[model samples]
Target chain A: MISSFQKLTIAFTVLAVFTGANSLHAQQFRPAPNAHYPNHALMPPGHVGSQMLLRGGPIPGYFQPTQVRCPQGGKIAVANEGKFVAGQPSTLNVGLLIGSPYRFKITEIPGLPGTELFPTVELLDRLHPPAGLETRFPIPIHLTAQELRMAAEGMFITRVIYLEDPTNPVVVQDDANRQRFFDVRFNEDPLRVADQLGRPMAILRMGSKQPRMDRQTGRFMFSSPPVRTIMPVKQSNVPEDQLQRAIISTPSIGRLR
Target chain B: MSKTMKTSSRSYLVLSVFLASMMGCITPGTTSSGPLEKQSFENIPRPNQPASLTVSDANSKPIHRASPAAHQQRLPAGVATQQGPATLPPQAYTGPNAGIPYPAPWTPPGILGPFPEDEYVYQGGDAYQLTNVAQDFSIDNLDEEDTIAHYHTLDGKIEIERTNRIPIYAPRFASIRRIDGLNQYRHQDHVYAVDSPLALDGTAQNIGQEQVKQHVSTQRNIGTRASSLYRENQKLRDMAHQVASTEDSQMLKPQVGDLLNTKVNIKNSQEAQLSIQQQTALAQSDEETVKEYAYDLLPYKILANNRIQTNYHYEIADGNSRLDIKKVASKQDALPGELLEFTITFKNTGDKAIGNVTIVDHLSRRLAYVEDSQNCTVESEFFVNPTGKDSAILRWEIIEPMNVGQSAQVTFKCRVR
Candidate 1:
């Protein structure tokens, strides 16, 4: 015979306690020492995972615990904090979930004349990863003046994928066979499997870094915004031989060709 | 004889003798029937005759009554006489004796009184003195004359004495000729040589090369900046034009206006940038010329011959005040965070005066000028780069002329950034 207000107050208290515990647990959880990825060396002090949660429980037709975050949920971020002075060298950090055998291709938004894209190899070196991530790797992107201007205008990573097994040790070399493999497995369109999985696999809207204010602390801090999201890729129902032919005919994969 | 007869006879004899004496006095010389004097004046020298002869023949000849017209008519051809009819003297015989000759009125001795003193006169400008005897007289008649006096006598002599003459003003004529197997009164053309001590120092060539290098680098930088600004300005202009043509919402109008304003500003700034680039190019050319001239003349070699040298030296001291000082970098080297005071001790070592002396120092991108650190005694200007680069130009001009062995110093301060 408890009053509804009292019951509501109890439930709220319980919910607060549960959320606080989860936050504390997440903070205290550290990866194993033997973990392949060294978290302590890679991440900055006080680094925190993004607070966004994906809406769907799991993507269909994709491995569970995909080890990849959807674009809308702030899994990947690009920032140029303290690195945009003109006529001096600057770097762009593209944050991604730590997954080996990954490939990405940055393409200029067509019809934008001043947009420039350096060869992908220069941007995708193994050393010099993104800032503020332990369980993630970065494609350290160096920008020329023209490329920086293009980024300011609006550029994007049109494709990002985790290759299950790459035929070539280096994806940039001998990319035609790799492109064929990608087409056969993921359909002619690279994002077809991602579309079926109902999650964004592409990102856009690169802009200058903005400062965010913490309401409780009354302090300003800079952070990159969540990447732009795209609708799931449309399925093209075609025969297997046609798909194979399409894969062979495809010119490039992740700028590999 | 009776007393009355004797007295009468004596009277008659005395009267007869007196009449005879009177006739002798009246017809002493040839008597003229006209109003002319009844005497001969042949002993009197003509007015135009030399005074030396007149003085010498003073006691030699008897005075004679001569017609002036007859005397003038007797002169040699081409000899000029005073214009108009000549008149006779009232008394032609007027000397020590009735037979002695009288002096002519137009003679030097008569015009200048009994005797004339010797006088020296200069005939040229104040800068020089060319002497001549305007008037000379000697009672002894043993005076000797030089060629200059003879020349002056032929020409008209000036009558002013002069002193304190300069040798340059002396009358001198020179011509090129082969004498003793060498060219005389000839010289090789003079060339502008690098003669300052600063130019002759071993550090000087390095300084010139360094300055040239900096000049080239600065020119390149200016060109790059101008090109970048032009491209940006063009892009902004295009963007503004596109925005203006589009029919956007009212909220976007302010943005469009801003864009247009930005474009105009950029275009205006581009003009300044291009101007700086052109100026830099011209300055580079001048620097190259200076370098070539400095290297070609080889002031060090000239210094070895003791032909050209300088007392010019520069000192660098750093301090917060005049009394408190510390040694800073030397020549063209400096460290970061140094407060440096540069004092250039400028000296003129040449024989003549030097003017329009100017010293220019360009600050590197890593230095900042100290506030109010310029010298008040000289004309100075500090110019900041219009492109917002961290470099500046400093110039000090010495307007007053500096004489030989004269020295001056200019001081300024800068802080390393």
Candidate 2:
């Protein structure tokens, strides 16, 4: 008779087999903190059957699978300390700006947000400079099913480049270029993104900046995580009927900044 | 099974948890840490959420590596890889070398190389450089067993989902060109010969109808005797003279004279008529067709018998990598150069690939030529590689490639503008 411990061990073994460190979603969409995106984006479904489908997630139904929200408004004021003062006004409430009058709660999200901070990363997500071959970090990040949906609907975070790379220009055409960026998605379970509860992150590579393990081989030497922040923007005015489906957002994201 | 002392049991458990967490061996909330440069999230909190993460021990022994290289065995735990001597430049360390299973940082398949040297890659921002795509850190000690189990939980054991196939739509077009000098010549001197029965000039000179009929009737009866002949001659001469003096007679070649200041329009009308070949060509232009319908399945689907569900998970511009099956819906907005997304569902009408799958598609020669074929069963074209997800568009230009007997589909972006 197998004991519970044995069963658990077997289950653990099975789990390891299913996880690949080099998933595009894991790296691009914050699959795991350490997982890198090896497959780029169009990876064959890791498993078969609809069981792999995740419908519900833990976020308050607002932060979707691969999306996050930082809503502003409603009004807030603090008195002398970090406490809300009832029936009294304070300086915090003055001159406040509300970006949008209304915001929709999404059950689907792409990812919460990525940071360039530390203590959460065990690796980076990047590629070599074209010498030959290089390794990237195992970015263990995965958006929940809800996040994936929101991303598909344009309700998630996207990358906007500021400084331009003459060598690599940015084109909005879907088929043009997304290989260098990390995309948020939920092909894998969010909870099991990295090892267990590992935070998601991204590494940026650009210019001649992509470090190489061996410059001769064009392998990745080092890379910086793509910097990002989430803010509110006005919703589009186009009606839903006229807009084509899947023209909304990308489930794949974030190769560079 | 407990080899260590009781006191070390907790340490062992902690070690186990740590290992599981690091490798993402298994768990519902197995998340990963970002690279050395950045943190993923900063103090994230929801109105109501699990206040704390699952507790595990951190005092466990450090897992050391005998050798990062030459292990041909398994990767070492907790040790930086040994790919180079000296410091691995700032942010270097993409992952393991080619031929080895992907160890972290290095997430790309086959080999690490620069982005395809093209405008698409160079102009895509710094993010598009092939070197820029690699992650910043490297992960190690990955066992094949781990991947298998994780996949099992997701039920991904060679069980392929409905793939978002890239349709090879190489549409061809006939060039509509213009000739430079045809319309410049405008002919203004050509004369038109305007003739009508009313314009006949011999009417006044002709004999009365009764006399003419009488002469004709008697001539037939007498069989043209000398007396009748003389009368016929006189009448014929009068008609001839009337014609010769009329305006139309001057227009005729025989009567016109060099000294006549005015000329009949007939002489120039013949030269001004349009060429027969040119008229025939214009008439045929009415029947030319400019468009054609495309076939649904250009090649074969992985399965048969089942109605294949379609998706737009794959992308074309990025060398066909990022795949998102569940979220995409049919629409023109998916991307540029894309057409329509078709979904086909098929079951094992035949045997499954079981492990590796290769779908062959012979390109329709009409639209686009084969650039190249890699892992593609057949067919290739220029500027595009026909492989797992590298099928291209501008193809349907001639016809859609759809195979009968199997269900297959793809969400494609059609070009309108």
Candidate 3:
């Protein structure tokens, strides 16, 4: 019986060898066609592999926008460059900012269409009424190149106020500063500016409403917001580049007003 | 003793099978695997034909209305989709950079196009010659709304109207000059077949004189004013039409005034000229009407010197698919302070093996120079880009040729910051 089994195995092995030899011969004997022009991989796994693997820049805080009384609202990644031609499924990641640790769910607004409705946005910690965390779904917009036009396409400013000073924990001074912030001016173009390759470019605020300008080009938004610019402020202590736009929410404004 | 030996032999056999399966039949060399069956597309619609001047004559597509007549849209709330503004936690996170978000990274998707609230707004490229000011068919507006009237011009030539602005036509038809050189030796019968643009039909649609003047002023005036885009585009249409029909066909006046300063209807309505003595509108169209076209290259042939010359006419059809850049060989990842790098791959999927072919590889100013590929005989690594995205072409002019089932790769780098 063992001898018979061995003979059967030998036969199968011979068959496999013959098949391999045949395929090899065909590959060698037959001439491959000439390579054509403009042959590209359709977003191969290797190509754009880094972007997919990282999912880094697509959204700020990586879809986890935590709202802290510490600073202004966090930024989210929410744009699409390239010509944004029709029918392509482009992605935009919006981060949610919840001030404190909390659990909440998103509820669609009563009247808005699903496509038009931005993911409901609010402090999950607060879960306030109507426009609260319950109603504010994360902003998941699916805009065609055409629908994008209807979006506000300019620069504007949004501010995040911290509760007084973190270290001193003083509500008094924060309120006063908050009162002055209301006086600041800003422009509001909603279209996010992307670098040519579609990377997000920083949006700035010109101290005054008018754009800060050298002779030819204009200044970024958020250049100023009633800060003590001349008051012994050092450059290093500042968190970000001067070109970046930023506004912090202060709790002191109530007493100041 | 014999029984024990048999049991041991069985164990040995199982072990050998396990080892064989681990390695499989793979060979050491990375030789080409899989079948040689490359899918050949038969008779793909050739996209070279510029939109017919008749496209201008075609009925204007209607604009998209977001709201129904029953419920018109009111002013939309100024809710900002500021991507960087909010950084959410990574609960169900599953990406490479799926960690905590910080100063926040700049993502391509998060980058918004033109916005009204932005302190700065910019538009470039040119409009399609046939579909001028086409809001509906714009590659930019293909998704949400679909009303468009504007067309795009082929690449290579830059036309600055009194407005001094370009519409950023699509990527396909952008051309530097009209004629793509033909195979003079092949001896084709039709003169127009060899010509990229048989006749440069100048159809200047009449935007009112006021709009023209605003363009003559500053682009700011045109951009801010209502209907300014419409007016400027109309003027351009009329200008193209006038060029197409005004000149005497028999003569190349080569002079400015040789073009008749007359109106050609957008609908191609026929009109006659009055007799020099009589106000009679003369019915005329033919060789008698001078038709000066953009330059055309007669049947000509030269060894593809391994250089890609590109004319960004920017009028590709909406149907064109995004290139598979992965097939391109040369590339760069981290750029030097101001430098950028790119690698593009292309293959000959068509039945005809391409030789002496000139390709348009779009490259912009932002990318700086590094290494280029062997496919291109000549390279332009120093091209500066005022805009972020540009395309570069690798013309198969010289060097080892390609076959029907083969591919070529190229790489380039540039400085963009």
Candidate 4:
């Protein structure tokens, strides 16, 4: 009995009401991004935070040896001006050829059990080797009070290396020249040196072998190859003030043959 | 026509009565009328307003009213509604000293006696004595064999007599001198005469002398050649002993004597008196003994009588809970969005009666509390506010009583701003 237009209007009104209700219900059920929920599906196992957020990178390859030579007419001297007590600073003077770019770092090699030295070094300007023709860089080495005390107490003899930056990209003419520069420093046995005057040595790295890594675990399967060449060089005991003059006066470069 | 009209009226009356009864049964206490008229009738006297209309009968007494001044003096509605100040109920005493303040015990610093002074005596004899001689005294006519002799001589002169007597048979004599207002003996000086050559059988004495001479020569030769070798051997042994004792293999290296003089043993053993060069050579070969010697040689101070003692007391107060919480962070400042770990420590600073405790911490909007970071054996949950983003609440309830000096800790992690 209803007219066709009226019936069509009624049908459209009923359809609109149902669709609006359905859309609102769907909106209410949709989860919002960034909302904190009780479920922890994304958390890491063992309650450990992201590795990148916790500790820093792996241990640095601190052991590297570079060739260090005394300038013509001078000798390298590593001297402890004060008594070798804990918290004392020692001086190391190395003679280098003028206009040569060089970087140096000191690394503490663990000695007998309980013997430790905090390996730290101040970097000097490589651009300009000191002004005069007699060029020697006097690097001050500071030992922690505990390290010094341990050394004095004879807990352990500390062995430190006055290493040249082996990673420096420098051009060398021949193997002989490189060998001459890379010769050992402090040739005397480290154990025989005064504990206060830490045994100085050069830790030479011959070459690196390929390292193997596990395919599935992504962890290193094999240890890095060991360094074979550790040549002990002879270090002279020269007064700090006269060290520069001694370098300038010597006619031949003090290189271990 | 009159009879039909009467019947219709009677029917109308009957329908009206039935309709009224039906309306009453359908809706109790409501009338079937126009909405506007019903609203006007209901609003005539508001049910909420107090009844101000006075009802009077023919024999009723006149109503009395309070004056305006009396109304003004009446208390405000808020004051009139409030009950009188409550009387505090008496509390039952739990113990003899309940509700009493106990004074804290006082302790004073330990009184120590003065350090004992070391008694020192001069070991060297008359070398340290100062001498001032005003006059010289001398003795004369001294005899070697005579035990007693008297002589007068010039001032400051002393005679010496040598006797060929064995030490046991020699007579004792004392010489006194005044030094530093004190009398001290100067009896160290004594001289004895050499004995004449003994008479012996000719061949036997000569043979004995020749044997002595040969023995001396052989010893001299061996001494010169083997001394260096023996010393070197001893040094090596000492060094080996040191290396063994210290168990530090790093010190084992070839012997080098260049810096031997500078090397000092931290622990100086009974045999540590060896020369520095020798010790270094020994240390190069033997690690333990050398390390032990070095340790002994180190100048270590002895600490004595430096400890302090203290006593702590825990007291509980009436109706007061004494639980405390301390928040600690591994690092205070971090980069934006960096993860930081936080620790909350709860301590019971008083007596053991402190009951179960509940802790609630509101997470800052900038931080995102990590899931499952709560480290406690209790009911703990993280709740996010429905209307706020990045804001949450962390709640924990501890059901056990925390005793005095007892503490527990909870830890969680969050991304810091």
**Model 1: DockQ score:** 0.00
How would you encode candidate 2's per-residue C-alpha lDDT over A152-222 as one tens digit per residue?
33332222111112122223232211112223232332222221211112211111111123535322311
Worst 10 residues of 1 chain A by lDDT: A120-129
Worst 10 residues of 2 chain B by lDDT: B144-153
lDDT of 2 by residue, B40-152 (tens): 22232222222232112111212221112322123235434334332121123223111111122222356433322110111000121111111221112211101100001
Candidate 3 interface RMSD (Å): 26.5
Give the better candidate number (1 or 4) by lDDT. Answer: 4
- Model 1 lDDT at residue B276: 57
Counted clashes in each candidate structure: 5, 192, 196, 43
Error of 2 at B251 (Å): 99
lDDT of each: 0.31, 0.24, 0.25, 0.31
DockQ of 2: 0.02
Instruction: Give the interface RMSD of candidate 4.
Output: 46.6
The number of the candidate with the highest TM-score is: 3
Docking band of candidate 3 = incorrect
- Residue range B269-332, candidate 1, lDDT tens digits: 5556544543454467655544443442354346468533545454533221111111122223
Candidate 1, residue B231: the lDDT equals 88
Candidate 3 lDDT, A85-137, residue by residue in tens: 12211222323333211111111212222322111112211111111122122
lDDT of 2 at A256: 23
